[model samples]
Target chain A: MNKIQDIQQFLQDENLDAALITTPDNVFYVSGFKSEPHERLLGVMVFKEAEPFVICPLMEVPDLKASGWNFEAVGHQDTEDAWEVLAAAARKRNVSLEKIAIEKSHLTVERMERMEELFEGVTISRIDEKLNSLRNIKSEDELIKLRKAAELADYAIEVGCKEIAEGKTELEILMAIEFEMKGKGAEKMSFDTMVLSGPKTASPHGKPGSRKIQKGDFILFDLGVVYEGYCSDITRTVAFGEPSEKQREIYETVRKAEQAAIDLVRPGVKARELDKVARDVITEAGYGEYFTHRLGHGLGISVHEFPSITGTNDLELQEGMVFTIEPGIYNPEITGVRIEDDVVVTADGVEVLTKFPKELKIIEA
Target chain B: MNKIQDIQQFLQDENLDAALITTPDNVFYVSGFKSEPHERLLGVMVFKEAEPFVICPLMEVPDLKASGWNFEAVGHQDTEDAWEVLAAAARKRNVSLEKIAIEKSHLTVERMERMEELFEGVTISRIDEKLNSLRNIKSEDELIKLRKAAELADYAIEVGCKEIAEGKTELEILMAIEFEMKGKGAEKMSFDTMVLSGPKTASPHGKPGSRKIQKGDFILFDLGVVYEGYCSDITRTVAFGEPSEKQREIYETVRKAEQAAIDLVRPGVKARELDKVARDVITEAGYGEYFTHRLGHGLGISVHEFPSITGTNDLELQEGMVFTIEPGIYNPEITGVRIEDDVVVTADGVEVLTKFPKELKIIEA
Candidate 1:
């Protein structure tokens, strides 16, 4: 994918010996292999001059080979200490271990200490910013997977809307949506499929429970799908039956806020400007205190990635930058309403990947 | 729960001022509150003398309070720096930040540097070992939850078996099993549900895909359930129809090895002994090298936890210690067969929590 070579070039430019990319997403990004090495070590060690090598669990070596990585691939046994194996692999390169760049945001303190103990006063710098920026701009191939993922998410929302019934629990609807997603070939969800309902929706991060849906309840489905290697997140809140005036107002305010943010997505536009436009929409509606979280986040290989769309982040929206535009108002006394859409910035303007309707739908169950 | 008080007492005994529990599992363990803060921050700061506090994203403050945590629970907005909020909370305790304990295994180097920057030259000790020891022995209440989780896992396996048929994809069977698990009130799977078929089973960590199941194929179902807060993992591989002689031999050898390990679990026995016994059985059967991974891992609130059951670990199993005793043989030339069960070390011997038939089942469809 030329990503490893790019890292090597980055190391040369920064005058670093090497860079250790270990986070599963970054590993997949650097090498064309995807694996979730839970607890086990998985890394792609890229040297400025030497050829890059991928180190993973011994069993995944064959899988890595099948993934088309022509570079050297090393694996460690379950009984062996993976860190020492990783160190030995690096030593074979014959590069002086003086300065190295690691993902300081992902590498644990324990692992960093082990690396230091192995390499001796190796001045460790961060590879986070460089990696984040490189990953921010999506390639054409990534956009294809992302667009497919968005289509699946839109279908999931449709299925979820159809599954809403009189006495069905939140879990039942959630199970139906995920089961349908699996049938449609979504290997996994970007995150846990949240199917929060009623007052439970007031908490932005509420879990799907056995709470039965009833009349006058606002059901919130904040979910995403991972297709190929890309991710798409979309949230749609619909009313079960007839809703109160307060519910409609909250829904309208959130829709306006979300739309405003998406409209401001264009090349050369500061990411924070979009956030302010969305925040201003919700604030002018007198729901400012209720809108608690950030506007949105970047989406790609990782559902939540670089260029956080927050009021504080001043990152400019360059062409090919894909992200989410979500804004919500959560008032426990009334109801919580959130509308989100996956968007990609283009040279001229923005393209909203998720096609789910933003208008509040009153589902007559 | 007196867990917070226990941590405070440990702090006094260890001559440390405070301990920062940032890992989501540890956060849920110390405070009765559970949360996954993603990129945001969530922690439990337990001081020796001052009152402990739970810090989370501002949006989750109400949810934290609802979890019945009476102690002070602080929240930070997305716009505000979470690390600074965490430091300010510690400062409010009025305790000298001379020495502090942190989960070095979970806290990232970036966060550790931030913490060190906040508390100038503070001696940072590790709370990993102490926390691991505390969580190793399950309480009676925890056992109840584990038992329920194990039952759900057994049910999931039964569902998976029933759904396996000719022309059925591995993901189809996995979807059905997970759908039924949700129907039975299982909030989540301990890990990603694995249903590997035929040659795919040869990879111990194979992912379920669109590959159709055929006759003479070894179908592996490695899954778990999370009930309440406890987790249970179980793996069972059955033949789709009449298997080949080699498949039967591998299956029986794995079964025998698993049984031998399960029989060896008891108080005073080293964790490595079980791994060795299982390894010896497979080695005697002439497929020792095929059993690539470790025997299993300790299980509780977290699916994979302390005291990994490997050939090198010498940790002694004590009463109320719960873990998985899984042994498998994955030969890509033939097929993979794994037999797993959740067992707890009792005062006298062991009690297998997962009640599922381990006999080689030939599913004729």
Candidate 2:
């Protein structure tokens, strides 16, 4: 994946003097270094001709070097502004600081102002689209990491299914799932692990609470895992005890919709096509309004990335693109059901990374 | 806490036409609603006179209402730009967009540009300082939530201590601690749960890995919990077995430094004073160079908030202000030891919210 080369080519083709890549995800993508700087600054500065350099908190220098980034890494003390360091470092390359590009959507107003103040008269433009386009297609190495993440996510769902029992609180099951995941060498959950049960499941983004799982409760486990630097997201809803007719109907409808979306994932297929296919499946089952929100989002370094699967996005699916196909029916009066699978677009068709069964699993408590 | 009224008063005093609060912490501080908007926009538009309005994704409108935001909550679909919805909602207030204020430190350059494009000739100024000042002091209810969060964090450390074993990997101990926290009803960790053991403990901000803890090694548990909206951060390092002379010296130095800083916490004392007191202690121990980074940061809605406990910050301590007092001595050639505590400035002295003992514990595991 000619990452730095791709960014350098973008700079040269656009006639921009340089590009300042902020945002931890983009920084990691460019430099192969991972550091959650939080309030501190971490940037990857690429040039039209000069070698790229990194500017980060002084403490993270060793980490950057360990990450295989051999380029100059300028370290700033806590008291110093990182932009000043960046400007000084960029000047060291003897390049004119004019017409620079940046991650406009990520660089804060405060930081941007600081950058402007440091680099006098520099015209900045957005490089977000270029970076997003470059990161959209995953490489074979990234796929390997994603596949491992998906395996752990599937195991989390399996643990959630096993831990579901009568009188067990939603968080109790969540704890068991996360505990097992960490023990299995998962770095961390891609996002907050969700385990919702009974009526709580109807809340589209429900927080696991002390509400105990009762008989006939439908337990929904939506969780993911981060393996290395890649992420995988999976959602699986299981029925505890025998489910009611309405619950069974909702579960089957979401399963069909999710499968419909998964089936349309291939090269040249528009992202919107998958959304339309899934939406139609849910709409035909008379739960169109219940199936709210978009069908899916691209998944890789971040659990949610680019090329959103919605009815309006016209982006064509490309091979090596990994994403989640999650379609849910949240009906408070009836029941909530969602089926999710992490899939990677393939040259032929698709490879579903998440192997967790989509069929209804009614666990006997 | 008279939060909204305080914001309105600030707007009136500053002669601001309106304020666009975008950061989730500030939004939740002003209004009761909380959301992780991810890439989508979540903003609270407050005026000097007009009722505050919230703009969020259509899917989160219900959650916003449930969170007790009774005023207008303009919900935007996934396809719609939330900034457009926010602009329309502000226009409906019939107030001049001129002389608006924004959280410049949190708002992205892209969003700031969008605002300028939408509201032509709008003069925007930073309200970040005002917001931070307003949130500096905690109320009775806020303190209650913080205390609960601290209690949970202490319990987490207790769990970690019990789970420590000779052959256990760092991740195994971390899993046990997090599992206990989740079962005890922590919303989530304020940050990633950190459990570093042996040589890994020397790496400040090290990720818990499969590194096994042998006999003579230091185990550091640095984690926090988010209770309701408040956050608590605590770091405690313990010896798995009999420590070396250097390890003991480092531990004692950091503990003394942390205690010295905590002892200096009172009304009217400068934030820098505490940092100096801690820094001085470590310096006198001949480990001045080893102790890097700031002493701590203000803790409340956000784990790392305003009034960063740095030697350079001149913020004055006041009653009801909550923050962490952490001091560490990280010498890669030797070992690392850190001790942290959550403390609240009281009328007379400081109330240590984190009750975990600071005394070094030598666990014969």
Against the unseen true structure, what C-alpha lDDT does each candidate score?
Answer: 0.91, 0.89
Q: Pick the candidate with the highest TM-score.
A: 2
DockQ of candidate 2 against the true complex: 0.61
List, residue by residue over A37-71, the lDDT tens digit for candidate 2: 98888999998889889899997898899999988
Candidate 1 chain A has its poorest 10 consecutive residues by lDDT at A1-10
Stretches off by above 4 angstroms in model 1 are A162-168, A196-203, A211-219, A238-253, A283-290, A329-336, A357-365, B1-14, B68-70, B161-169, B197-202, B210-218, B238-251, B286-289, B331-335, B360-364
Question: lDDT of model 1 at residue A264?
Answer: 80
Off by over 4 Å in 2: A165-168, A212-215, A242-246, A362-364, B165-169, B211-218, B239-250, B331-335, B362-365
Tell me each candidate's TM-score: 0.90, 0.92
Candidate 2 CAPRI assessment class: medium
**Pairs in steric clash, model 2:** none
| Winning model by DockQ | 2
The 10-residue segment with the lowest total lDDT in model 2 chain B? B77-86
